[model samples]
Target: MSTTAPRQATTPTSTGWSLGDIAVRRVDEIELPRQTGPWLLPDATKEVLDEASWLRPDFADADVPRLASHGFAVTAGGLRIVVDTGIGNGKTRANPAWHGLDTDFLARLAAAGFPPESVDLVITTHLHTDHVGWNTRLAGEDWVPTFSDARYLTSRTEWDHWAAADLDEARRQMFRDSVHPVRDAGQYDRVDVPEQGREVAPGVFLVPAPGHTPGQVAVELRGSDRRALITGDSIHHPVQLSHPHVHSCVDLDPAQAVRTRARLLDTLADTDTLLLGTHFPRPTAGTVRRENGRYRLLAEHGSEIAATAA
Candidate 1:
């Protein structure tokens, strides 16, 4: 494996982390407060937020908890791999916040040195609206694959579930525009990974982490002596690190989500594995620590062994 020097923590901004020679960066789309009622963790009321004092200002405020929609760019093994394309421009979404998003997401990706055509692989951890929106972009009159030279990878089970799901017209439109276009272009690859994990690239693999979505998987990167996991909605906020049972409102199976969260946390606790949360706000990358029989996210602050940059 290739080797890289360690860097410092710089969050909110476009931060990048390195595992050996593999570089992972976050491309921002939008970061805003989401309602706690029927949106985030329904049980995460003022009382719960107050109890989790560490979530203040960054992840949550006095009112509601906040989450971000962004894409992660991983460069390794002579390939530029992007995970979870955030909400794209000019799309009709069921949620008003996500509708017709005309953000500088593409420009930001280019600024990070990975343009659309430069991408080699695009992986959507699950078929969520926010996760797959940028899979395609609006052309003169039709949606086309945004990464013209890349192969888009979607979980086989996720594709089948969303295709047959009893979704409304708005969600169906999502599949038609963002998903089908790539498949039609023969630029799509369906991945069926085992629970133990499936290696997709030189030092990268997919770890089965279901229940947030039935086929949700976490992307794992391993170097010679360092490791990290890109948690794709499996644990939405850091509060879930303290309270793994707090399921998000968007979870397809709340009970199963809790189990998966607990299992993932347990497996990573006290290990060297760096935890990179997809929706986590500033200082998004961290490590899990078992504290007093509970798990806590130890945010990277230029002190941890792992290095992050933008």
Candidate 2:
């Protein structure tokens, strides 16, 4: 079988949002196969998606919701932070679409001006296979931490839950190669986040965002002029904004996920804070508004800062 990666579908322009002194850039990884939406969020049916016309052209195609895997690179307070790592270049994954793939993820990151070694912190919104895959890279026969100088952070609750769960071989392999290597290198730290949230860096906070995962936390980037929230799978797609009850197929607690989504939308409704979804496709940042007693994203594209080649 051929082992070449498919040509990247996204344009090479760098898209980023400005938060006063802070800059948040989108590092393209791979636009997920169209099947990802149906498989991951089965409840977001075509009929349901049709209700939100604003979702078309950008967030979703005609019938199916489009999703992409990427990370948010933030430069704030003299600290460089990455919100979540996308599926790594080469890793064994149970999901056929995510397994043993090769892509120029690091090159894209560098083009956006965040070389791995230059990153100061990597905030893993939660410990999921795709979110944590780039935490390590192959070193001879073993995996090693990708960010040698950076400290990895996750909620203490998230770590402890996964630590005790009976992980399958795929999950175990993920930790063995990606998650554990960072910890083994003494570069991993778990923070305790309360109801309000915990500030990891200047103006960056980790707010309690449970239900998706017991320990899931949404990142809040508060700036002097405006604020943005980095949703860590708490809100997977734009359809969820319209129908907050539409839950992901893998949600640990569907009911709680609904509640969390409701609370998050309520907080962001008719506000200036930009909502950045961890799995949202292109034009990934937007503002929330209450429309006809429901929520919808007013899509926002960032200013182009640099050019890259796929």
Candidate 3:
């Protein structure tokens, strides 16, 4: 395990997961650095009325779901796969939003009964600070791949864009400190999920839901009676579910991001599919349903009730 023992379950409001008909507990949260930058997106200027009406928050004490965030260890294709690694400790960054700080990602992974070496495959839905923070861990003078025995999977296109030297410092360093070490170790496998959507494991497949980033993907997991998606960043801040026009200023292609978000929102709406979002109020999983023309997030089980009770 990453470390022994588990931290206290600080936050109580979290969703749950059951895969292969086996219930799994949330691995708890880790304290990672985040930028409570501007309350809302700068490009998206709004007032109190807009903030309240729109699913936005004021720049107050924005405590992103630390304990709320969870990592699910599931049995897929006869392999124990760890979908995403939350923020890791001892990572250095420049932005005040993300700087020098340590998180209990490994400890939480351990808390969830997984050793760093236990993960057979580590699938990165996308390349973002928090999403890939634990890809490499600080070891002595240099960073080392977090999971020594696991094959780290990332899209070939994503690896290229961030690794480019001409990109901004934040983007460059994210690739250097967080991603390159895994590549350097030769443990990295550039999975070019062109069109057919390669099935990394029996029921766990990578759906090419690009746009937020060039090669970003939404992971699809289907078992006997259940199916779900690990959405990387296709939708951040659940408000987008209802207001698809609200694109994060950082989006590589805001228009394309909008199109992709719309398509995904439609695809999962009113279905029994659960969405494990990277930033959706933790346990980070939910279901999407259409009301009038927009959608809202419902707890995984809540959706089941709504579906059957209807």
Candidate 4:
């Protein structure tokens, strides 16, 4: 991996913003693999994890920030509608794969043209550390909201689950660094989707895709005839695109996660939709096409690893 990341993907439009009024910018940060060290696949996940073993070597190096393409939509006048912030610097989660980590997810936000003050809405699909890291920054002795003027929106169920205090050390640590500070600063607002999954923004809505987290959700974006869905940790890798039955090691309810995945896959297959994933490698935005009940990632431009190599 290169020590430096390539520039954020770009396109030209004299309008001076990206993709018309909805400008998306990638924030640099990484969410370490939750599982590391010698670990056998859970009997249930064997087939799913093994299905794409040949591609695992492509992500072996830790030098390049494995950013989940932390990004958001920007208005023509520069108002920021942040989707999710990436892992923060100096967080202390107990999972060995995520321990001993540090990165500048905020600086990248600035580089992407979103000053801390420009953010309007900070939306999170769920309450995982990676989905909410930039929610707060280390300020002197306490963690505080990185965006002073922004409202941090989260699912009501997710907020309640992590704050329950019965979670193990790793989960407790995740909550401490990724969530509590935003609430303490009076910046966090828990939004209830009584229907379980519902729209949270004009063009964005939450789909109750549970099981990964008790309240795991997917954000859907619609504009004119175009539509996109952000599958937050609901499906971790593109490999899962073809094998929706594979369970994420972090899901609160593995069985539920599978059902959500199946539902999502069904939706993708049945509709002409694009997807933006929190962890679907680089250029995370793309279209999904179904072939014999299987799916493949149809990148917006093309594959990155191949272009970078050439």
The lDDT of model 1 is 0.80
Q: Which portions of model 4 show Cα errors greater than 4 Å?
A: 1-20, 31-79, 302-310
Error of 1 at 42 (Å): 1.3
Q: Which prediction has the highest lDDT against the true structure?
A: 2
TM-score result, candidate 3: 0.80
Error of 2 at 94 (Å): 0.6
lDDT per residue (tens digit) for residues 232-256 in model 4: 8787666666666656656778888
Candidate 4, TM-score vs. the true structure? 0.77
In order, the Cα lDDT scores of the candidates are 0.80, 0.87, 0.63, 0.61
Worst 10 residues of 3 by lDDT: 301-310
Tens-digit lDDT track of model 2 for 67-109: 8888998988988888899889689887877888788888878
For all candidates, the clash counts are: 1, 0, 2, 1
| Cα RMSD for candidates in order | 6.9, 3.0, 6.9, 6.8
Q: How far is candidate 2 from the true structure (C-alpha RMSD, Å)?
A: 3.0
- Give the per-residue lDDT digits (tens) of candidate 3, residues 147-189: 8999988887876766563766776677788788898999888
Sum up the clashes in candidate 4. 1
Among all windows of 10 consecutive residues in model 4, the one with the lowest summed lDDT is 301-310
Clashes of 1: 1
Alpha carbon deviation, residue 18, candidate 1 (Å) = 1.3
lDDT of 3 at 1: 8
